[model samples]
Target chain A: MERVVTINLNGNAWQLDEAAYDALRAYLGAAEAGLKDNPDRAEILSDLEQAIADKCSVVLGPRKSVVSAGEMQAILKEMGPVTDSEGFAEGAAPKPPVDVEKRLYRLRQGAWFAGVCSGIGAFFKIDPTIVRVIFVIAALITQGAALLVYLVMMFVVPSAETSEEWAAAHGLPFNAQEIIDTAKKRFGEVAENQNRMWKSAQKPPREPKVNAFVSPVQKPAAGYGARMFAGVVASVCALAEAVIGLGVIFVVWSLFTTGAVLGVEAPDAWPLWGVIIGVVVASAFVTWPLRAARRAAFGALGYDAAGSEAAFSFFAFIFTVGGVWYAFQYWPAARDVIEPIWLWFRAIIAPGGF
Target chain B: MNPDEKFAPLRKGLLEFAILKVISGPAVYAADILARLQGTDFATQEGTLYPLLSRLRRDELVDYEWQESQAGPPRKYYRLTEMGRAHLDDLQAYWRGLNQTLDNLGTFGGA
Candidate 1:
């Protein structure tokens, strides 16, 4: 019978043979000694061990099963050696030292409570919303300690000024400064171009003798009727798209649930046409006013229409999803009647209501 | 320089070169440099390297740029000034001389 020793790590237990246990203990000792002078080494080693444990669980099964000495050696070997030569066996290579000068910066964009989410999101290549949600959960779980940490971070961590700043925060080379500087130079060029355009527009007309400007008169009322009509039309369209999108999601969800409960087979149909039309109408409703707002805010900054359109698309998707979810919760009564209509419409258009 | 003599100065030169090289590329800082060079038996403690680096900067042979390190804090990156380059050149010349002398001494001793 093989003797087993249990090692607890990150709340998970692993059973190891005596030889493997000795090896692991020896390895940990070496790692601790090697990293004694380096403050970050302990954390790095901990994370590395966790990573190995995670990989092991996937590779080797439960903690109760006897883990062979070879298996334990393999895991330690894969974790990379505590010493430099030992690292080579695990295919570890020495990383070039990081250049700190170029990467540090103050983050300016994506601030909700102090730009921590935005900075972290950028560093980890995750969406800011996900990071924000995780932060909120962490804060709640830690009984506000996480919030305190977040507040401290807000005060202590500077906003990232450039890509180099982001790179540095992630432990990348500071050489990214050259790239950021180039981008800034390009932005300056764009600004200069806009300035020249504005100057040309403001220049007095070439005609030598023009009558002194007749007193400019207020004509705000002249376009009031047209503006009012446009506003009404826009409001109506927005209302219609929002109502229809919500109605569809509500009907589909109700049908799905009822069918599942009643042991009825859900219809197999592709609702591609409805989705496409819904998306298009919904997008137009949200986009038109948003585009106008974007133009007003960014026009002077030389932003193009395409960029505004892209922003509109991204925001519209979020709005559409939110609107559908709200409809599912509040308009449950409409589902019974609307379900058949949705199905019929889907059938007529594409024969399948997905 | 004989083989044994060459190893000592060469080792010292390499250490100096490592410091200069790190500083010249981008300013990582002394602490970061020491941390990175940890596993290698190049130098034992960071305390010694820092003072020597500071002296080098003060001597005008090397200059420094203040930049932030990702690991924890702001770091000072050292760069080789014109004077430092001149010093490195002189050191290289001395290394060549020592190497040739060691080669000659080895042959003479064998004879």
Candidate 2:
């Protein structure tokens, strides 16, 4: 006599012979293992089992009898492709995937120092004891500095919580996976949205080939013209200074030579133009040093040399030479003819000058 | 029919149907269903029932509603949708065809 065992499946009872039961049990166990890591495994398995049970009932009929191995195999075959068996129902609306957020916590229960190890272990689904042992070894190697780091972490790191406020404070998400997915989706959506918006907002693209060539030439030419204009302005200013210096020298020379020859006292008061020439000369001397310093500063700040120092030096030299030449032209006229009398008077007052 | 035989098909059919059917309606509370099916041979453990219910729901033939139970935590109720009913109709038709073929084969030599 063949022995039979009764089992209930999908809220239904079934009386299966030992062979059938063993076959099903093995099948289900294997299926379960295969689906262990599947997100929808639970749902898929449930549906498949129901379909199997239903098929079995129809095939076996409602009578107590020993089911032969042949019959069992036939039923399994008629069940029509277990491999392609619909795991999930067709047209089951796709649900947005859910994300589970996990937290790290320092457990008060099993802590040696700051409980950081215990908390991290809990968060990562690991053994707290192992974490603690690792920390102990780390502390020994670091010479107790690990203790200070742990204390700082304890004070700095906030406890993980599901609340939005807590997550925000800790720079985490209440639902970390959900938030990340949503953010990624949103970014994609925004890019698409922007494209759509721009499509509507913008005018259609126009052919620029006709105008492009002219634009390139115009731009460069405008820049070149601006530089030339600036150079001309600088040169004109230098020329004006040189002319003014020459004019002052002529006036001073005429006044000093005429005044000395007539025995009239050369004007004790220097003309304002002389003072102007002196100032211009002093400015010329200072400008080169100042500009070199500026160029060095700019080079240090990573600007390429574009003859900025050369331009400054050239302007300074022009002004200096003009001033000195004008000064020399008037120097002989300004000399006193009664130098012997002046020297005797200077000697009595100060030996060095005499 | 013997009581065992008479009720056997009905029991089998109903249970199989219920598992798929419950998923169609609302979330079927596992515990409650267990209690309801208890005295009958249909009673099953939570582990077995839950996994099956999940499968039906996954297939989309049946959907589940998670209703808060006053007695305990939220319970999943299963319900049949239009799709599940259509599937059942197809299955019934297939069963009839199979039965006719079997009857014809059995009587083939005699006729």
Top-DockQ structure, candidate number: 2
Global Cα lDDT for candidate 2: 0.47
Q: List each candidate's DockQ score.
A: 0.03, 0.04
For each candidate, the alpha-carbon lDDT, in order, equals: 0.49, 0.47
- Candidate closest to the true structure, highest lDDT: 1
Classify candidate 2 by CAPRI docking class.
incorrect
Per-model TM-score on C-alpha atoms: 0.24, 0.24
Model 1: what is its DockQ?
Answer: 0.03
Q: What would the per-residue lDDT of candidate 1 be over residues B6-108, giving only the tens digit for each residue?
A: 5554454466655665555555655456666677745423323533454566568787776665543343566789898888778668778877886788575
lDDT of 1 by residue, A75-182 (tens): 665554343322322433333333444322223344564467877776665687898999999977975557656643543354443223445555443223333343
